[model samples]
Target chain A: MKRSLPLAIVFIGGVVFFISYFVPHYISEEILQRQIMVEWIKVISLFAFVIGLYSLIHLHVNKIKRKVDNWQYSILTLSGIGVMFIVGILLPEKFNGGIQQGSIYDWIFMNLQVPLQATMFSLLAFYITSAAFRAFKARSVEATCLLLAAVVVMLGRVPLGETIRSITQGFLDFPKWTQWILDVPNTATKRAIMLGVALGMMATSLKIILGIERSWLGGSE
Target chain B: MKKFFLNIVNLDRRWIFLMVAIVVSVPLFIPSNPPIVPARPVQELYDFIDALPEGSTIMVCFDYSPDSLAELNPMGRAICRHAFSKDINVIGMAFAWPSGSGLGQEVVSSAAKEYDKVQGKDWVYFGYKVGFAQMIIGMGKDIVKTVQADYRGESLKNMELFQEVKNYDDVSIVIVLAAGGTVQTYIYFVNTMYNRPVSAGVTAVMAADYYPYLQTGQLIGLLNGMKGAADYEKLINIKGLGTRGIPSQNWAHIMIIILIVVGNIAYLLEKKQTK
Candidate 1:
């Protein structure tokens, strides 16, 4: 009974929401029910964020109390959080008027988070490059095709290709060729992924609506 | 000595990180000149905005943070500029978070001000509605209910701009400037429900996943990452963030290429020596 309650909510809400997309008459009822369910989800999710905040606080506070190794880092992490929370609550919404100042949160987010995240994302460039160099070996025709496609995309996207295109040797338009690579092969890959995602999402939604899948609620049994 | 050097080449990942860091970062301060190729996806995106009828309602959904601003913000600026130029009524909001509303308002209003447009008279922000997907669905019914107040807690009823807009249809074009799940959620709720032709400015990681939606005509257009932003800037004849970042991207891409080539050569040579 305990497990079924959430499963029931998921099933009903999921089904009604999905169905109301087609049938216009039951739309108002569908929307009202969905809103109520969503509000409940928001309240729960906000609490979840609190739990995360609490965990963050606990981990750092515990390190300080225990005087663990490198406990200095904990102070930095804890204070950053405390400062942001305090400022977000206290700031006059108008100092940020016209522009959502984001204020200190914006400041921290731009300076600290953007660079850190960009660093992580930029690492993918070297990884992809090396992976392509090794894995893009031309052992077969298909392998050769993949190699050629990778090469074309890599070169066509750069300044060298534009410089070459300027010399009028009639090699081919890099921009046009790049478009084909993205619009054709990339599109094909995307479509295949989409088909798979569509199937998976459909099945998953069906399961939720049918009360078959409930791991999301933590142990349906 | 060659053998020892090659052995060290295969030795540690830290060396590679150091090499990559210097390759990508040092060129940031140095001046560089690299040709940027405009793309069709971005052009199509610009053209869509160009084609929108004057005073058409455009929903600018700020679903990303500054972390994604490197890639997403340029396109955001371009699109905002385009919307304001056409006198498109922007109903701004952030489905993502409290921070999102602020960031979005800044970008959207920045463009509006450039065109000498009035805030509440020409465009108004619905601000942020809390429940991500639920927020989408709520805006589908009544935007005011989900967002009774702007980010500043001003009642939506007081805003003259949103007076006629009862639901989703009131929003003619919905564009998501995001780097994360915000686009996906908008696709599911906005696209799936009202068949809203939601466009997006997304990061490169998420770009590949969107082609399927594009093929199905789920999203009318897409501007993918910095490259997409640059392309849009070119098409619009605006020189901004995307244009400025070009030289650095070029040098970075070259370094990445060289590293890949060298890394592979080392791997092959090591294999051959072992054999």
Candidate 2:
């Protein structure tokens, strides 16, 4: 009964949405998909967020209890979440509370969170440089092409790339070449991949709708 | 000379890290004006916003986290400044991440303040919502019903900006500044479904992925990483972070190229000697 009920719901919802694209009637497209389904989604998404938050806290708590390697960081994570929640939501409006600008929530977010996240992302520069120096070798024909492309692209996207035009008295334009590579080969490859992905997604969605892909429902049943 | 090349090949990675750090940092202090010839994609975005009539509206979706603020914030700020300077209504939103809402508020409001643009009237931020695709699809049908309220819990119905602007039809363009796949989501749902013109300011890593969409005319324009931000800043004639940060980017790129070339040379030398 549990499996059948959920399957029935999925089939009805999926088929209606699938057919709505073709129908385009005001009631189906506007009222059903846009308004009605959208509200349901918003509500379901909120619930999903709550579940996600609970799952996060639960996982971290379990890690702490287990004394796992690097588990101390979980405490920091939980503390951050707790502090942000209290300052962002639980506090009263009289105290300049809430996630609005000028609030404590905004202050922490801008000062602490922003810099921390930026620093983590910035480390990519150091890591990529080290990795490239160690591993970016042209051992084969394909590797050489990739290496050459990478060098051209790296030079082309920066100010140094544009300066090539001035240096060669307008004879050499690395940026222009880079743009061609991106526009032609890059676009063609990306389009092919995207089309494949879209088709795969449609096939997967249809399978799930038709009850052939029941993994989302969980369990073997 | 062979030993020297071999030593370079075997040098500790810490040396590379130090070299990168030095190159990236040194350029910040010794500033030079690197001429920014605005790329075609960037110029298209600038021209599109420039062509909008006064009182027209555009939706700026801050679909990135603070991790991307360095590359994306400038684009957002530049777009807002452009829109506000021309008396265009700005409807900002961050449906991708909760953290993005803070960025959206900061970007739009900071620019709005410069032009003395009133909030709820001249500009309104819908803030973060949980449902990304559904929220976008809903907004296409009716924005007020989809968003319900602004970031501060103020009803969208009360906002003067909402008076004439109701849905995707009212929005002049949707510019998404994102670091992730949210831009693709906007492309699939908003552009493909509703036929609303979409553009993006994405991280350089993800920029190449969207070129196909640009060719298909799905995206009106694109901003690729910090360079794109710098290009937009040049067009807007503002020496913002994008401009300030470009010199460092230049040096870093030069350093990476030098490293790659040197590494390859060392590898080839080693190969010759072994043979």
Candidate 3:
């Protein structure tokens, strides 16, 4: 009964949402979309966030209690969350109805969070160079072709790519060549992949709706 | 010679890192604006905005975070500048991520300030909304009803900018500057469902994947990464960070190319020696 009940709920909810898409009636269009679907989803999303917060705090608290390795990091995480929450609540709404501009919260987000994230992202350049140097060996015919394509595309996409074109008097234009590669071959491959993904998504949706995929309901009976 | 190649084959990566650092940093001191030839997609994007009738309202959705600020920010700023330069009204919103609301505000405010455009009549930021697809669909039906207030807690009902914009029908085009799947969401819900024209500005990595959409007319134009941003700045004839960063990018790309060539040569030499 425990398993069957949730599955039935899922089936009913899925079917209703699916039907609501096609039906143009006011009840289906307005009531279902605005009140039931959007409002409920928003409320559920908020609750889910709360649940996530609780889960995170609980995990960390347990880790600390058990004195796990790197338990000190948990303290840092909890402290960060606590401080941010306090600041957000205390700060006056300055800009739009959100956090106050130049408040401690905003300052932390802009100065600390922004730079940290950007710094992390910037590391990709170094890693890409290292990985390319290590793995991109022109050992075989296929590898050589790939290496050539990579060089051309890389040259074509940047300002230096255009410099080459100007220098060569249009006899060689990396930008034009890059555009051709991206437009034709790249687009073809991407479209095929997207088609496969779309079909897979549709099939998965159907499976969930028909209760064929109950793994979401948790462990097997 | 064989020993030299062997040493190079196992060369430490720190040297490559140092070269990249020097290549990227040297351009900042040397001001070189390499002539920008706008890619077809970027040119199309520029042309589309340039061709918009004066006083046309374009919906600019900020769907990216700071991680993508380096790329999307300049594109967003350039589009806003273009819109303001042409006297096109803007209705800004963020439904992708919460952080987008703040980023959107910064872009709009800075552009509007430069153009001496007022907030209510010239542009309005609708701020972040919770539900992604539902919020979009609702905006399609009734934007005022969906988004009750602007980012500043002001009621959007009284805002002059939104008076003409009832929904997607009233807007000229919807341009989404995104680092995530929000572009696809906008394409599906806004463009496909409401039949509204859509365009996108995405990070370089995600640019190649969206070409099919551009080809299929689902996307009117696309701007990919910092290079794309540089192209837009050139078209507008206003040099920004995008322009400044291009030299660095050019130098970095050249460095990578040199590294790859050198690495491959070393590999081939090693292989030949073994044979």
Q: What DockQ results do all the predictions give, each relative to the true complex?
A: 0.39, 0.83, 0.68
The chain A TM-scores for the candidates, taken one by one, are 0.75, 0.93, 0.92
Model 2 steric clash pairs = none
Candidate 1 Cα misplacement greater than 4 A, ranges: A26-45, A90-147, A168-170, A217-221, B1-8, B11-34, B97-99, B126-128, B268-275
Candidate with the larger TM-score of 1 and 2? 2
Candidate 1, residues B113-206: lDDT per residue as tens digits?
8999887667777656656777777677777766677765678776777777767787777898887767878888788867777888888778
Cα lDDT over the full model 2: 0.90
Q: Candidate 2: where are CA atoms >4 Å away?
A: none
Model 3 off-target regions past 4 Å?
A92-98
DockQ of the two-chain complex in candidate 1: 0.39
lDDT string, candidate 3, B2-40, tens digits:
677668758788987887889999989996757788888
Model 3, position B44: C-alpha lDDT score? 94
TM-score of chain B of each: 0.90, 0.98, 0.97
Kindly report the fnat of each predicted structure, to 2 decimals. Answer: 0.36, 0.88, 0.62
Top lDDT model? 2
